[model samples]
Target: MAFSVLTINPGSTSTKLARFEGEGCVWQDVLRHTAEELAPFGTVSEQLDFRLGLVRSALAAHDGGAVRLDAVVGRGGIIDPLPGGTYRVDPVLVDRLRLGRPWDHPSNLGGVLAFSLADPLGIPAFIVDPVCVDEMAPEAKVTGLPELPKPSLLHALNVKAMVRRAAHDLGKTWNELNCVVVHLGGGVSVVAHRGGRAVDVNSANEWGPFSLDRAGGLPVGEFVRLCFSGRYSEGDIRRKLTSGGGLRAYIGTNDMLEVNRRIQAGDDEAAFYCRAMIWQIAKEVGAQAVSVGGPIDAVILTGGIAHDAGFVRLLLERVQWIAPCLVYPGEDELLALAQGALRVLRGEEPAQDYASSVLRQ
Candidate 1:
């Protein structure tokens, strides 16, 4: 029998749900929430019940009408650093995500929504290649300062999926190729995938280029002054770093389409900032290219921003010298989540437990 899988992906302002049968996508829907709709919640974790309600409603409204599901897979959350694999949603994993330690983001809700539905049906629930997938080499973690080390947080799910897809297109497997995949969305992540393992990646929150809605790396002196300026609280400053900064800080909006429209309407400043964003991304791709020793098989671009031809052209002009630039626009995370579950169901890959020595502190 073909395995039935439901994939749940929670974003900053939307809940994306997909149903897949075997290797094909059966149905998909996105439940978008406005800022006003989410304002009542104290944090992302607080929206669990509210979001779960929408997930159930969306599944019920499917044409099949609440058919039995063999498994449920959610985008992974901010848990302990673990290697890339499909993980069963166990109590320990859920408990940690419930009380976010390092920090909280939208992905934290993945485990909550998955278990709520899968537990009632007595089927497996899993999360694959979470943002915290730590496969950093020992040297990658060492920073010039002894007190600080770089964290391995990137778009693991989308990057891994694209690498595998690119490999398949070339009639090879992901394990046999090396590539640098850049994910450009609300945030930007440039990852160096050596063979099948992501040995190094910049935490989307801290390193890399300023994205549509994220501040990315900032000048140390000015950032520190802002933090102590007392004009903003800790939470307010963090929000500024992630949501209020970036293009929004300059242009007052995160929507690239709007920026494109402005550029068309003779907004020279908007055109300049957008081009700057592309330039920063090209530098990030170049940095990761060096991280992967030897020749780069490809420099792959995959995310919402990749769809912008003008931006892609600008980036290509800068970094195409490093390697052949490959554009696989749009994130395929839902399909990737479904396939991760299918791997375990087909006995092609074993589902990893939440606890492991490498992940332990």
Candidate 2:
């Protein structure tokens, strides 16, 4: 039987809704929220009812109460670190999301919203590989400072999805291959996939290559001096490093298309910065290759920036010798969410229990 599933991915200003039957997406919509609309909510978690109403309305209009959903899957949020897989949205998980542990993010609404819609129907609600999926090897987590260990927060949803796709293309199962998968979007994640496990990865938000908006790795001594300078607040420095750095800091914009246009128009500085970012990405790929060890079956380039042929070509020139380079441009996170639920619903993989998963940690 083809399981029908509803997938919800909540971003900062939009809620992406999609319904899938088996492997195919029946329809999809992005419910964009304006600043004024979200202004009333004191916190992201408080906007649950507001976002839920929008999703409910969208589903009503699209499905017209005709389709019976087998399951509902949501984009996982920033919760405790757990391994990668589809997790059942139980009370424990919902409580964590509602509490917004660590910090509050718009994504925290995904699971709660999914549960709201699925609970009445007596169907299962699931959250796919969230940002907190930590599968780093113990040795990989260590740093010179024992207190400041590395984190395994990457684009796991897309990374795992692309890994499965790459495995299929290579006529191998996901567990049968060792690959280095690079997700190049707003942040860059260079991950070493040994068999099916993400043994090591640079936390996109904190390390790895400088991306469209993130600073990536910075000189430790200089960063410390800047922090002690007291010219900027903690929040200011964090925003600058994560949202105001990289190509935007160098070229005044984060849009790669704009950078490409400027380069074509004979902007040497733009071209130089672009090349530098690509070089950093290639270098990170080499570092991850060492983490994977042995022979890497393939090197996959994915996410939005992979659509840039010139950029991919430059990156390939540097890393292609390591293995055959494959480009899967753009991320389909909604589909990835649905596929996670389908894998469990179809008995291909067991659905992880959020409470037990956390306890095991």
Candidate 3:
């Protein structure tokens, strides 16, 4: 019998959960908690507990619904940088995740939630293709020696989903295509999927290019000046770079939908920013395509911004010359995580002993 699996992804402001029964996606749910409401937690752990309660209540309400689920998979958390594989997360993994010492994104905490809930119920849990997709080349790792840089390929889940769905729709296997995948969300990331695997990506950490929230890779002297401003600490600068930096910083709102609404209503400022953001995406995506030597099968755009018709049209017009473009506007992380766990549960996939969690190409 095909296994039943539940997957969870906790974003900064929302918790996304889904269940997959066999090859079909049975059901999915997303529950959001506003950051303002969660401010009292002071730290991530307290916030995690508060959100876990909300999820527990949601699961309880759904317990009587359509079908019984067999296993639960939270977003994978910190497990030394190992190769891509699914494992039944044990106590060791849970301890490491709770500490959030080495790696701690809210998404990583999904693995913790999955482990806590799955183990007690005697079900299996796993984090599939975590940020630890670190197969970085030696050069990618060394950031002037002092930093020993390790930045996550955040949004790999959605990017991979784009690759999978695009391949499925294009009548080609993923391994047959070399594509540049762009995930435009509250923040953004562009990845180079080479030889059917995501060889390199830039999202939260290091600089890529200018983004909605991030300064991207800025000039050293100006960047140093900006960070040295007495008004902001390192964490403050990072928050701006990660969350507060993007469109919100520019226009005071992160809602692309609202921005587009303004554009339609004849707000020239909104239209200008929209063009600028897409242009940035187009420029970076084109560069990634160039890195792969100009043979791009499709420029795949996924995530919330990808759902915007005006933005997609703008981006396509700008970058379509690279190749045809495809839009996979939905995120399929729950399905992706569930499938990985089901493979482990059914004995069809082996739990790879990932040597280096970060696959630095």
As for candidate 2, its clashing pairs are none
Better model by TM-score, 1 or 2? Answer: 2
Best candidate (score: lDDT):
2
Question: Least accurate stretch of 10 residues (summed lDDT) in model 2?
Answer: 352-361
What TM-score quantifies how close candidate 2 is to the native fold?
0.98
In Å, residue 250's CA in model 2 sits off its true spot by 0.9
lDDT of each: 0.87, 0.92, 0.71
Candidate rank order under lDDT:
2, 1, 3
* Model 3 lDDT tens row, 183-238: 87766787777666665566544567555556566577877798887878898987
User: What's the count of clashing pairs in each model shown?
Assistant: 0, 0, 19
What are the per-residue Cα lDDT tens digits for candidate 1 across 1-361? 7999999999899999999999799899999999998999988888999999989889889954548799999999887888998999978778877886677778888977898889988999999889888887888889788789787888889988899888988777888878889998899999888988888787778867998888888888898999999899999998988888889999988999999999999999898889888888888888888888778888899999999998889889999999887899998899999999999999998999887623653
Q: Rank the candidates by TM-score, best first.
A: 2, 1, 3
> Please, what's the RMSD in Å of model 3?
3.3
How high is each candidate's TM-score?
A: 0.92, 0.98, 0.85
